[model samples]
Target: MKNIIINFSVMIALLASCSPATEKKVDKKADSTEVKVNAIPAPSPENNTVLKSYIPVDLSTLVPIDVLNTKSTDVYEKYGIEFSGNCYSCDLASLSITKDTMIWTNVCDENDTFKIDDFSYSTEGSKTIVKTSERTYIITQIDKAPIYELVVEGKKLELNNKRVSRYFTTKKALSLFKEHDCGDFEG
Candidate 1:
């Protein structure tokens, strides 16, 4: 009976040592020994790099204008314009102009036709002449640096430098407009 008791005690001690609580502690210690890795930051551009690129314009602050009427202050309200090229990709395009400034936005992309909206062009030195919906004129004395932004699938991507031109290709531009049935403006 003494031997039996001794054996039972040993078994009980072994079982206790192997309990779930003890196993969990061992697991926690193992987890703590694991190393966590973080992502590295992207490298900055070289100091000598030159950047020149067109950015999409913001149009919320300006009023729309008829590209045809140079004298009227009447704002032109339309859905948007489509512009597609190897250089730009967007879904919609719009133009809004005030006395001195213009704002624009690109809304969608079909094949290559990227939509632009809220686009503004300076009418200060430019003369607006009545033209068809497809043909309108805003002759600027000096081409200004226009700001532009791109939205793709609800994700906004900005093209800040001309060096990024390599990312856009003619094939992609044609695909954008071709998908939308917009005439091949690139040709």
Candidate 2:
């Protein structure tokens, strides 16, 4: 019994030493604060970055007024953002979702406005990812609405996520923005 136990212990020790430690590499770029682990470098989109990039704003007041996950609003009711036009001040996109149909329109008056590509969206947990046939749109929640940070695929457009830069006050945008504004919109 003692010999058998000793042999088993020796075998376990040998096996432990023979196993290789899995190495995990974490690389963080100073520019974009995203930390990727053992990341495979994606072919950089000619006009876009792989991760969501935003201008850092003082959001101290915004958080208190933000409706992160409110009871009064549902996912479908929230409008998704669209950024187009070669200029940073492009017009916003609009979505009208009904029981049977979904409509997305580029509302900018500029002819240079970037258009939302033919894409579909699905929710991965609370985050909704909008993807075109070629690339995925950078979708994130801002003021309770889905904002897409995209690099106009074919154009030299610099489109910024409007939620952090300015307030979206369209009728549909207002419906959801009011929920977090803590203003007179109680419905």
Candidate 3:
């Protein structure tokens, strides 16, 4: 009886070790297959989807003299421009361009704003105000039309040319402008 119990214990230990070895082999195979799948080449830039074209601009050149005369919010209100294209909207506000990336803040309202922090080159054209940003905005200057293209990360986003009226009374529109931080209105 004692010999049989010892034999049973040894067998159980051997089976446990074998199971782990089999599992390790399976895991190694799966890892190799995953590596092989990941080795496939990504698409070339030329074969990539349509991209937006961002023209680097000098911010100093676009700053108007009148900017000092009025509040920043008022200045943006007087000259702010937006673009609509495809199904997206883009507002052109304060733009800072670096060697690698262009930092653009969209003046959505008098205050509410968002930044396009990681914009790079794209195939789509840009539509911008003549004196606001140095980049020429090239979309039909109509009430509703597709405007410029802004590429964030690797994705292309369209800027529609939609002007916000100075006399807009909608509560949402008012709130958007107030929420958008346009820097110091006094300075």
Among all candidates shown, the one with the greatest lDDT: 2
- Best first by lDDT, ranked: 2, 3, 1
- The Cα RMSD of model 3 versus the native structure comes to 16.5
Badly placed stretches (over 4 Å) of model 1 are: 20-22, 25-187
lDDT of 2 by residue, 25-128 (tens): 22224223442422334444422342322222221111111223445556433422222221234344433322222233344342322345355555443343
Q: Give the whole-model CA lDDT for all candidates, comma-separated.
A: 0.31, 0.36, 0.35
lDDT of 1 by residue, 1-187 (tens): 9999999999999899789788999888777655221222222232112211121222222211112333543222111122342224433333333333333333232232223343333222222221222433333212121112221222333422211111111222223222323345543
Number of clashing residue pairs, candidate 2: 3
Assess candidate 2 and give its TM-score to the true structure: 0.26
Q: Best TM-score goes to which candidate? A: 2
State every prediction's TM-score relative to the real structure: 0.21, 0.26, 0.26
Q: Model 1 has how many clashing residue pairs?
A: 44
In candidate 2, residue 5 scores what lDDT?
100
| Tens digit of per-residue lDDT, candidate 3, span 85-147 | 111343434433443443333444324333344323333333322212223322211211111
Residue 111 local lDDT, model 3: 46
Candidate 1 positional error at 112, Å: 33
